[model samples]
Target: MTYTVNCSILLTELPLLERPAAAKAAGFDAVEFWWPFTASVPADAELTRFEQAITDAGVQLTGLNFNAGDMPGGDRGLVSWMGRSSEFKDNIDVVAGIGGRLGCRSFNALYGNRQDGQTPEAQDELAVQNLAAAAEGVARIGGTVLLEPVSGAPRYPLLTAEDAVRVISRVKEQTGAANIKLLADFYHLSVNGDDVAAVIEKHAKDFGHIQIADNPGRGAPGTGELPLGEWIARSRQLGYEGHIGLEYKAPAETAFAWAIRQRIAQ
Candidate 1:
């Protein structure tokens, strides 16, 4: 099995620019992140420094999230939000530029929370358009655009594998874009009450990437009730060939110990 550290969530204790080196020092050769910038288009210097950090640390950037707005302030994403379509579209170029330089071929596009005034039908239509645009943008490098069902945000409507796949099918049907796919984050699915095993058994081959964190506490594998190792093994057995993204939260110093043990045991 292969793993990639999600520096954005796992290495929150460190400065943003330093997390790549920290991940490399901890023995991971590949890492992923949410959009590290506050703005859709950060300054050239900021982009340079970020790219340089990854290059200097010698780690592969395997996955990245497209800029979702104000995550900590409870904004899930911008793709479907009313009046933010231009902001979301602007972000595609930046995402593509970074991915082009860093060899990242998978980009996660968080479906935004439903706005107060916009009808659900309106939001879904806009989401499909933006997702199709994202898919086309990343296709230049043989990249994939990922859609995930999230937990804890009630306004965000995509809550099951079926929900995400429905939109993916729409993108394909409307735009003829085959590059959009599902991002199966086990923690989110479990928290949202989806049968994780059944999801894997049925849709493992459709996943563009997989992220993991144990539920109840969103902690590392051993600190919670999830059979994470078994699920990962099952995913691989069912033909999910991409890296397993370690997107759990824990004390940075000890976060990876269980993962190391799992690897040795495997």
Candidate 2:
């Protein structure tokens, strides 16, 4: 049997359970999503149910993203509503619970707006504290945090790799947990003043997960300006053995399937 490289199928605006089966049919061994609390997802189910679905569907959820507070991509941050602590806790716990159930290897954090009247240092401290708390819960279930940096998003106000590296160092320092790490999204990094493969090499140690999409237009592999084949070759050469998430939106699964096979053939 030919061993296939593991890649994650991004599940956005799709039925949750169907995502895995669809991904499996598309020739992918794993799947991913920005958030899974929607009605279509498995947020209400217990941990066992989540586990059973993935096992039965033959899909592995490499990572799950936390609520990207105050952005089009997410639920507002924990502190967005100060007086409603329970709501915030519920949201976070729901995410953590799913991570635990699915054996999620990493968690993605979308840095949203800093709290009101807070200095940069204070906001940094706040993020570290929150991550540490979440990490503690995730540790029991064998999962880590993978913070993301995006361009043109409120969650990514800084929008640069240097900034992301700074956040990673602080997150690790605060959590002091081995599992808390980073997700390197090529499309965002390429827009945020980082060379695609060069940044991958520079901070590969901090990267616990990776994702990709074509620039100018978020599309299939062959439609982008990135030298994806070269990127994939170097990633393998550098000893990276984690999921390569295809977060782009394709018009149909046909292109996605073709892209995966193309990468594998290369």
Sequence-dependent TM-score of model 2: 0.80
* Residue lDDT tens for model 2, 145-228: 677677765543546666767766776765675566667778888877778777767766567777777776866667878876
Q: Which parts of model 1 are misplaced by more than 4 Å?
A: 263-266
Q: Which residues of candidate 2, in runs, are more than 4 Å off?
A: 1-14, 38-53, 69-89, 114-119, 260-266
lDDT of each: 0.92, 0.62
For candidate 1, list the clashing residue pairs, or say none.
Answer: none
Look at candidate 2 and give me any clashing residue pairs: 69-77
Q: Alpha carbon lDDT of residue 221, candidate 2?
A: 68
TM-score on alpha carbons, each prediction: 0.98, 0.80
Clash count, one per candidate: 0, 1
Candidate 1's residue-wise lDDT over 1-266, tens digit each? 67899999998999988999999998899999999999999999999999999999999999999999999999999989989999999999999999999899999999999899889999999998999999989999889999999998989999999999999998899989999989999999999999999999999988899999987799998888999888888888888899999999998999999867867987
What overall lDDT, based on C-alpha atoms, would model 1 receive against the true structure? 0.92
For residue 132, what is the lDDT in candidate 1?
Answer: 90
